[model samples]
Target: MSGITENTKTSGEPSKENPSPNSSDTPDDEKKDDRMFECNICLDTAKDAVVSMCGHLFCWPCLHQWLETRPNRQVCPVCKASISKEKVVPLYGRGSTKQEDPREKVPPRPAGQRTEPEPGSAFPGFGFADNGFHMSFGIGAFPFGFFTSTFNFGEARPTPAARGTQQHMEEQFLSKIFLWMAILFVAWLLLA
Candidate 1:
């Protein structure tokens, strides 16, 4: 009985001489590992691969289509994390080349954009004349506000174009159209 129990224990436990079938060196394990690099959307190997900020992998074309389907609410398909074309990082495998693809619609993975830092200026206000720029902000009754702004009270406005010139005629025509629009708007407000 003791000898039979000992044999059963030895058979159950895998020995160096008889390797277990579930070892990582098997081809099945390798194929499963290849799946790990597959696109989350397509469930196949990634082409023009990109990785979201949340670390989910996707093929650029698949991800682009997903984003196009919902232009307003862009989020990661796998994790619902906020994502955008600008935010995803492209994964360039060692074998990938810089060759231009022929497909017009399916664009290649996005490349990182680079721009030079803006040159620092000694004086921040160098672009403006000290007294030339004036800005006023106020909230008042609509009619009073409109009159004050339209008449250009207490502000330097450019003089109207020279009388009888093409420019002057154009301005007058534009003003009349606007005056009609304002009157219609006021009428609508009163009626409503």
Candidate 2:
């Protein structure tokens, strides 16, 4: 049977239309290859594509063509690994689902939609400071800590605390520190 028919027979599930050791079809070859992740750069089903040391899959010729153009400084388009033409395999085989997909672990965020740090539910006045959403940085990457955490006192100029202003000059600096220190000392003694 042709590869087309074999593929159609097992659309969602993987199976051979007719099992035969001598059959020349995709099903028989399927066992040999399990990695079939598509290349993001070139659009093609690379069965024998050379797998870069970075674990990215690419067609041998296509990868070769890419590296050939820039021989001395060859880098895998997906993983940016320094690869040489001689090191690349002439062909690759389909990969298995059991094999890890780098894309999933390093899921590409849409432009600026990356994860940010938002305050947890336990936190009331502290969280990410953004226009919308509760603000949660994805996984471990968080930029915005709180949307209202910013101490902006105006809808216009964010900073109106002119250093030269009389109010600023009169601002109590030492008193605030003394008061807090005394409060801390008392609290500590009480707890002790």
Best by TM-score: 1
Residue 103, candidate 2: C-alpha displacement in angstroms: 26
lDDT for each candidate structure: 0.64, 0.47
**Position 100, candidate 2: lDDT:** 39
TM-score of each: 0.43, 0.28
For candidate 2, lDDT tens digit of each residue in 42-145?
76666334565555666555665687578567887866878754455333123333443322222231253345565444434332343222211222222233
Please write out the lDDT profile of model 1 over residues 1-192, one tens digit for every residue.
644433432332224432432344778776864666688998998887777888788888899999989977999998899998877767655456763332223766456767665535444333233333322223357678665554433333445677789987887787777767767767886899
Q: Which stretches of candidate 1 lie over 4 Å from their true place?
A: 1-24, 99-192
What local lDDT score does residue 179 receive in model 1, on the 0 to 100 scale?
Answer: 69
Off by over 4 Å in 2: 1-36, 89-192
